[model samples]
Target: MLGTVEERVQSCPECGEEIRTDHRFVPWCAACDWNVDPGEPEEPGGRLEALRRRLAREHGERLLAEVTTDEALRPRRDAASVLALALASAVHGFTVALFVGGVLLVVLGWGGALPVLGALCLPIAWLLRPRFSRLPEDEQVLYRSDAPELFALIDEIGGAVGTTGVHAVAVNGETNASVSTYGLRRRRLLTIGLGLWEMLTAGQRIALLGHELGHYAGGDTRHGLVIGNALGSLRTWLYLLSRIESPTAPEAVLNAFYLLPRGAVLGAAMALDHLTLRATQRGEYLADSFAARCGSTEAAVGLMDALMVSGSADVTLLRESNALRGHRGAAGEAESGLWDRLAAHTESIPASEYERQRRRGALRGHSVDSTHPPTHLRRSRLLAVAALPAAVTVDAARGSAVRTELSGARKLVARRILNGG
Candidate 1:
């Protein structure tokens, strides 16, 4: 809370329109939306992106139509999932073959003629091995000892979602949240962006948790190490090969060596993504269903609403960052309540603004990105059916304790954001 902010009436400085706001919040004319940006309009990524958007829109519309008649409860699979599984397995098998081939070449070449070839295989095998994530250096890591109440709430939500809770949590000053595995042990980590987390209500927070964890419950093969690492390795190969531009005669000769391999890798990467794209989309929808189950339909819808406004929140951050430049002056302070202002920015948006965003989303084929289904379709699916009560709840006491636990980290994040880090 921004300490019980009181409404003050005023005229918009730009449009001279009537406006209202509190001390911590910026006043903007409803007509002009001077500072309130739900987000900037999305730029088309390219031709492939346009095609993906069209496909996603069509698929999402069909799925929403399906959800209207079908009860939205447990997730279901389809033929696309089967195809995706087959393709994922094939990629993993190929990686395993690379290891076996490399090992055998080295072993056989120990006393054989192809010693040079065998040595080459070893590097290739190691290069393409399945890899997982590493803990982020930029984000603050939280342990159970560091924030017991927060982890307890996470545990409760995980249990509600039917997966073990995260082994650790990391907080950063971005507008995103994600679940990823780190280290050789592959222990689960939940990364929460305080920028987004700070703006959400308790219910919306639950929905966020459920949606990320739901990726687990839905068995998101796209995210699993099998397909994830395989596609990742292929991408790495593509990146490396792409850098070999033929600027000189010698470079051209060398580039020719990798040209065929790059094309092959690109084709392989596209196939993997193409085969799995639908399944990935399905996993997202399933995750949202889990979100609805754990956070209740109303809150899940609010979560979608939050995502829709994320770009604006990003703009708010920049706006605040620039606003602080004169005062902070090359040295940012941790004491400035940048987050309180961010939270207030969200608070200042009314229901009518949200409604306008929803309408715009339909015309825009609103999506979080190219990977997921359109937000308008996702929201419509939720609204098409009646929602059960939230399975997990964080009452006021729990919420307060969690906030208290995060107080230090929140201050650190605020300092980082204001400092232009």
Candidate 2:
């Protein structure tokens, strides 16, 4: 255990204001935010950054206006959506054609018709085969039977929105949570990150789940079989033709030969991404609406606020994980207070800090990531919607049981973090 903590006063170099900082908390001028995010003082690439922000901000604003007026985020067969599907179909057809051609040539070659041609085509066809997502063989997964209380909550939330139910839940040590599909059946999988989950309120947790599961109801075109697989195939091609950062003489020749095809694939990928951009963004907003409906508007808004502060959570987690790893390095066994310390640190954060993070998000025109609308806009839209009480709730007893069920997952994740594997 450490000694009694005391507050320290320091002058803010930029704003020249006295700031009180504690060892337990990150110190920065609440007034000017000096020394906070020093490395990322500004967004990189002056003019390009400005243009990107300007364009993104304008696009976000326009989308906000459209949604405000429409507010109907159902799957629509719009022109762009149709075009994307057509492109995806064409891409898939090309792959199938390659496969058929390769197999036919191989058969002919075996029959002593065209052996060399058959041999070359067979390799090409095999390489161009349709790729499918597979569940990671090593990643840990929790079935409903393993955690009934948690699955109950998840089921309730799914019913509140509109999902059959997730196939399983996977826990990770990252600062984000997401839902994914696996296999030909497209079995739903929910992965909740401890770093973000620990920082949330019970209600915010519901909102997070609602938002994720909402994607199923929201018709995320990018995740559809046609568009998604096509995008995957294009990515595979790009990967195969990708240039080496440093190349020897023969490798240089290969790179030069691959350049044109690489450029074409890159351009196609960009275009496909653009085609699905609006639909995906719409899906995200609708998901937020689902969050509001299931977890209440306030909880949904709070979840968005929590997302903005995830960077701070990430930084603190890095510090804590490094310290924890160092402790393990020095001792035979180390006590794990990783989650406890993270929760405490987040709880200790002042409202002022969250407000500052929100302001920074607005200035940066930040979305959850590059794929969604700006955070501020999302919050605004959530507020604009009619308020509703939570459709699903986890009482203290159930919540406790849920946590207990997650104990094993916590150990696995903590091991993953400290070991840095």
Candidate 3:
């Protein structure tokens, strides 16, 4: 400073351009026009938050307009088109037949042996077909007989959401809940996270259950699985193809030729996936709307707030669980200790920090690959809907029993995680 030192140059994290500035502070990149200053902390609820709020408000307005004008959230025809196209592309029968024809032509000496070589390549590619499987054995499953109170609540929520009974319920060691279809008949399986369940109130729990069951009520379970599986298959195939190698020059040329058509197919499949994703986004809003209607709007909103807070709460709980690995407590005592640690950690989080977390959540946006809409958008959509009374409620006694049952499951999951299972 005594000699008026020159400013240092640094690489911009965003654009990878060299940032040169004479100023001692507030450095910025000219290439991408992004701030390159590493010293400055980001402002709380900055421009991104403002932009997200505006967008959410506008989206909410449009949704309300559509509800008033169209009478319902109309199904997207583009999604159906995408599903059809994906199904058609997945059928490789014609390509197989062409490979067979090429083999025949080469066998009869109608052309060079290249056709037979290409036909042989088809079998290699077929052998490399991506295999898909579902694994639920690792998760802790709970039967209705095991947790009757929890089952009763699920039944109540299912009834309110106009769905048949869930096939089974499982405890997932996370801060979220999901409903998925399994097996040939597509039986609905519900997975509830103990971390989340522990933090929610009875009303919030009803909203949570209704929200997941609402996916089934909206036909999302079946259609979403189909589109998701198709897209996953397309992505996996592309990844496998990209991993394929050619050691020789001729093989490299052949591989190049093969990839040309394959790339085009993958591109088209990606476009369809994009369209399907849009429909899925709409489905998420619809599910939120359903949840708000089935439970009180306040409860639904509270559940979302809980989701934002649960992330931090879950991390804190997991850290505490890790510290209890070598403890020689009895089974029930160990479980109680885990819950006690979780509660203390959760309560220790200050109100201001929780508010900050909520603000951060509001600014968070979903990527194209994400299945759900952003938290802020979901909140806005629910706020736009008319308020409704809660469809179901659990008495304190029943709620306590349900929580006790969940605690047992939570202890099992915690033990497994801490034991590095």
Candidate 4:
């Protein structure tokens, strides 16, 4: 998604309808009532107290692992959903063409050939769209922009967590993040929202990114993307069928004959999507665990607060601003084309308005088929994961220890060079 040029001043997060700024970065929005920056550390309370507060703040809407990553969840992407979409699309197209041809055939008294031709065309088109439409790695990278700082951090975290290199990272406008894998080699993509950056404290943002990368560490991205695309095809087919009744007319009759079967194809596709979704949700917890293991549980807490603050703040502003204009927010805006628009709405609402719809309860949690899980669930899961035991903490003591290790290593190297040993 393209970023809008800073224009048309609106209410500030701290003071509404008074001042506007081009900068998207913010630690807190006082006027809008949100919190993105990491909160001040709580006083030394018991471990349980910290955990309790985190849970109370989150309200139990967390993502949990529902399958084994190495087995059940890994194979989903390349299996059938992609093919199903292809098949459904071909059928839909052929059915339409046949309907058109049938009309001509009826006029010409050539009824026998019309249905046969339609059947042949329908499945072929359905199969081809997905085959041709597979996203290249570079295109996936373009979905969100990345910065060098973030990349360095990912590299550090990957080493700490003992994973292969971080795959892909991008920025969207929403207060969200996700991980996905599409095939056998097990490469993964990690995405974060621009709003997430605007809302989170530096430490918290690191924790959040680490959590997404954790999905890769746990092995999800290689299969998830492919499955998602396949299920998407199913959704498209079923959705079209659900909208029609008859094929008597060019649009109607073709829809009637092709859509119903395609919808069935989607049902299976949706099931696959669900499996991936469930596994991904679980993968979130593993990433969280990794982040906590890296000595940043407080960062996890800060991430949650940032999500709540950013989400509430962004929505309050966007909704009110959109309300003044008397139109649905960007989500309601028409797409560039049918396929593009359908894919946009299907994939996820644009980042520009995700928090707004999410806040208003307009978006369903499970019913959604996007790379990221819902914001609320993400926040809660982070909090819950923060409660897990950790191997280290991001404290002054830890910093000193690392410094000591480096100093000792430097001294030993210097002596070796000096003594010519």
Off by over 4 Å in 4: 1-149, 167-169, 179-190, 221-226, 239-242, 245-263, 315-421
The sequence of per-residue lDDT tens digits that candidate 3 reaches over residues 135-239 is 388788887888888888888788887777687888866788988867766777899887777677778878888888888876662255445555555555555
Residue-by-residue lDDT tens digits, candidate 4, 1-421:
3234353345555555343333343333335534322334434243323433343233324323232222222223443435544544554454456456545555555566765665554554454233322223322242213344345556777776767545555334345776654344544556554435444444565576666666666766324434444444555545555545453567776766675576566556544543344444555556666665554767775565455445454443343334334332432222112123222222332343334333422234432323444555554544543254433334555444433433332333222222222
Better of 2 and 4 by TM-score: 2
lDDT per residue for candidate 2 within 1-421, as digits (tens), equals 2224568788888889998876555677878766554334455343323443444555777778777666665556688888888888877887778777767777666665566676676666567666667766666789989988888888989999977679889888778888878887888889899889988899999999999999887777887778987888887878788888889999999999999988887777766777777778777888998898898989999999888777767776666556665466742232266677677777766675676666666665642245778777788888786777998888898889999999888877767765664
- Candidate 3 vs. true structure, TM-score: 0.70
Ranking by lDDT: 2, 1, 3, 4
Lowest lDDT sum, 10 consecutive residues, model 2, at 44-53
Per-residue lDDT of candidate 1, residues 1-421 (tens digit): 2245477788877788987665444454667665564356677664345655666766766756665676744555777666766776776777678677777877776766566676776687678778878888887899899999989888888888888788888999888898988988988999999888978989999999999988777777777777788777776677667745436988888788888887777667666666677777777777888888899999999889887777668887876666667686633442456777777878776565565566667656634366787776788888778876899998899889999999888878877777778
RMSD of each: 5.0, 4.0, 10.7, 17.3
Q: Against the hidden reference, what TM-scores do the models get?
A: 0.82, 0.84, 0.70, 0.46
Local distance difference test, each candidate: 0.76, 0.76, 0.63, 0.45
- In angstroms, give how far residue 86 of model 1 lies from its true place: 3.2
How many clashes show up per model? 0, 0, 0, 28
What local lDDT score does residue 251 receive in model 1, on the 0 to 100 scale? 86
